[model samples]
Target: MGQQVLYETPQISIRYDDYAEWLHVEWIGDQDYESVVSGATKMLEYLEQQGCRKVLNDNTLVTSMWADAAEWGGKEWFPAMRAAGCEYFAWVYSSNVYSRLSTDLTIQYTAAGIVILTFDDINIARLWLQQM
Candidate 1:
C-alpha cells in the first residue's frame, strides 16, 4: 500500500490513501459551517489532483452543525465533485437520528453519483468502496 496523507485541522482530520482509492475524513472538535466547507473544498481539490474517485466520510466525531452553512457547502461541492469525476461518497456514522436523516435526504436529492452509507463497521465501508 502507498503512504496516505493525513490533513489535520481544528475541525476535522482527512486521510487520503492512493493505493486504497479512498479519502477518509473524520470530523473533530467543534464543526463550524464555514470551516467545514473550506476544509472540504480543499480536500476535494487535493483528491482531484490525486485522482481519487471515492470518499468515505466518518462524521461520527462531528459535534456541532451550522445547518445553513452545511447546506451551502453541499451545494458547492456536489457539482464540483461531478466535474472532478467522483463516483461515490459514503458516510460511516453512528446512529445519530437527525444527522442520519439529514445526510440521507441530501444524498437522495443530489444529482451527482454520490452514495451515502451509514454504517457502524469499518469493514462495511471498505466493502462498499471496493464494489464501487
Candidate 2:
C-alpha cells in the first residue's frame, strides 16, 4: 500500500507508511501543546485504522519544549494509543535538549505497557520498530 498523509501543516506532518508498518510524524518548527494533542490524536487514529502498532515520531525538527503536551501524552494519549493496539513508540529524539527533556518527563508518566524508545537516528528507530 502507498503511504497515506493523514495531516500536514507548517508545524507538523503525519503519515502512515504501510511498508514500514508504522505511523510517521515529523514535527516542524515549534509546536504548542494544543496542536500536539489534536494532531497526535489524529495520528493515533490513523495508526489503529491501518493496523500499525508502531510509530516513528520524529521530533528532530522541533525547536521548542512542550511540557504540557508531554504531560497530556503521558496521562492520556499514550494509554489510549496502547488500548487501540499500539505496542511500540519509537521516538526520534529532538536535537534540542529541552525537547528531549520534555519527552523524558512524558515517558516517566507513560503507562508501563507502552514500549517507548528514544533514538537520534531515524533509520535506527525504523529498524527497531521493524523488529517489534
Candidate 3:
C-alpha cells in the first residue's frame, strides 16, 4: 500500500503505487471534465517519476457516472496519456458497457495497448501487464 499522491480534489484522489505499475484513482462524486483530466495528468507525471512506461488503471473504487462529462473527460485524458509515454493501459471494471467502450476506444485510438477485465478475475489483467 505504498501510495503517493499525484493530485487531490474534493471529489477525487489520484495516486501511484510502487508494487504495481498502476495509477489508482478514487472518485467520490460528480466532477468537472477539467478536474478529471488534470488529475489524470498528475497521475501520468507520477508514473513517469516512477519510471513506469505503462499503467494499470485500477478503477475498482470509482463510483461516478461514466456518461456525458466523464466520457468527454476520458477522451481528452486518454490521448494525452498515450502521448505522455504510457505504452500500455488496462482497467478492471464492474460494468459491462464501460468495459466494452473502454476496450473499444483503446483499440480504435491505437495509442497504447489497452485491456479491460471483468471483476471476477484479475489474473488475466496481470498477465497482460507482464507481456507489455
State the lDDT of candidate 1 residue by residue for 1-132, as single tens digits: 664666787777778876777788777655556776777787788778778888888767655443545465566677788788777877775355555555555555566656556676767887888898
* Prediction 1 global C-alpha lDDT: 0.70
Cα lDDT of model 3 by residue, 32-132, tens digit: 45655666667767766666665665545444444444444345656666666666666566344553354345445443333333333446766676686
TM of each candidate vs. truth: 0.81, 0.93, 0.60
Q: After superposition, how far is residue 96 of candidate 3 from its true place, in Å?
A: 8.7
Against the true structure, candidate 3 reaches a TM-score of 0.60
Which whole-number lDDT from 0 to 100 does residue 77 have in model 2? 88
User: Can you tell me which runs of candidate 1 are displaced by over 4 Å?
Assistant: 94-98
Model 3 has a clash total of 0
Q: Give me the displacement of residue 21 in model 2, in angstroms.
A: 1.4
* Candidate with maximal lDDT: 2
RMSD of 1: 2.3
lDDT of 3: 0.57
Of candidate 2, the 10-residue stretch with the lowest lDDT total is 1-10
Which has the greatest TM-score? Answer: 2
